[model samples]
Target: MTMKIKKILLTTDFSDYAHYALTYAVEFADKFKAEIGLLHVIEPIIAPTDFTWESYDIAELEKKSREYTQESLDKIIREKIPDKIKATPIIRYGRSFEEIIRCAKEEEFDIIIMSTHGLTGISHILFGSTAEKVVRKSPVPVLTVRDPEHKFEML
Candidate 1:
């Protein structure tokens, strides 16, 4: 059966693994002639110190952080994505997997392509795997890419 993949959501953590996955995402997009949605989810940093008018301070911090993030996103599009394929940068603040799933559903993307950290043992138990969660929860198909060159070895 032929699948109509008009839109593809590409997620990244700016890691080498994610950048490696971009190669696959780009190949898929080119083959399907689909537009690419580049998604980067940033979790808010919670400070331990208590402060007056925390919201204001947090808002200011968020603004500056987002500005740099948007530029990073734009740079990725300009440097990595080809001229033939259409790409857009999307930034969302929240849990990575949740935002990825939410964006895929809200934007009606055909699939989500991302890199897996392949976390194991303690790291896996403590942090869990974002790609795994997205695969299980996403409303659309998920393509998880692993960078064969990078491996996490336990000390």
Candidate 2:
């Protein structure tokens, strides 16, 4: 069957690895003439039981997180992604893999593209892999770009 990618979801953690994946996503979007949706998921903040954390504090933290995520997204759009590519920025608070899968399914993205940290051995066992989890759980196709260990041309 022929695959038609109308909408592409690109998940980023604002790390070097994620940025590397952005290059691939932009290239694919340009070639396919697809709209790009950029998503950044922030882990929910847990209040310490020992210290009485006020609701206002939590609110402030959420505000800051949203602002920071927006700024980063804007920077990528302005500097990395080309103007011709239709792109939207989204910020959510939750588990990364779950949030990504939810967004991809709910937004009706044709595919999800994200970067893998390329961790292995004990570190991989301890930290697990978000991309791996999403690949298994996501309803749509998931494309995982690994760290830039191999030289590849970027369009």
Query: Over the stretch 2-115, how does candidate 2's per-residue lDDT look in tens digits?
Result: 789999999988888899999989999999999999999988888886657754588889889899999999999989999999999988789888999999988999999998
Q: Who wins the TM-score comparison?
A: 2
Candidate 1 total steric clashes: 0
In model 2, the runs with Cα more than 4 Å from the true position are: 52-56, 118-124, 150-155
Worst 10 residues of 1 by lDDT: 117-126
Q: Would you list the C-alpha lDDT of every candidate in the order shown?
A: 0.88, 0.88
TM-score, prediction 1 = 0.86
The alpha-carbon lDDT assigned to residue 117 of candidate 2 equals: 66
Residue pairs with backbone overlap in model 2: none
Name the candidate that leads on lDDT.
2
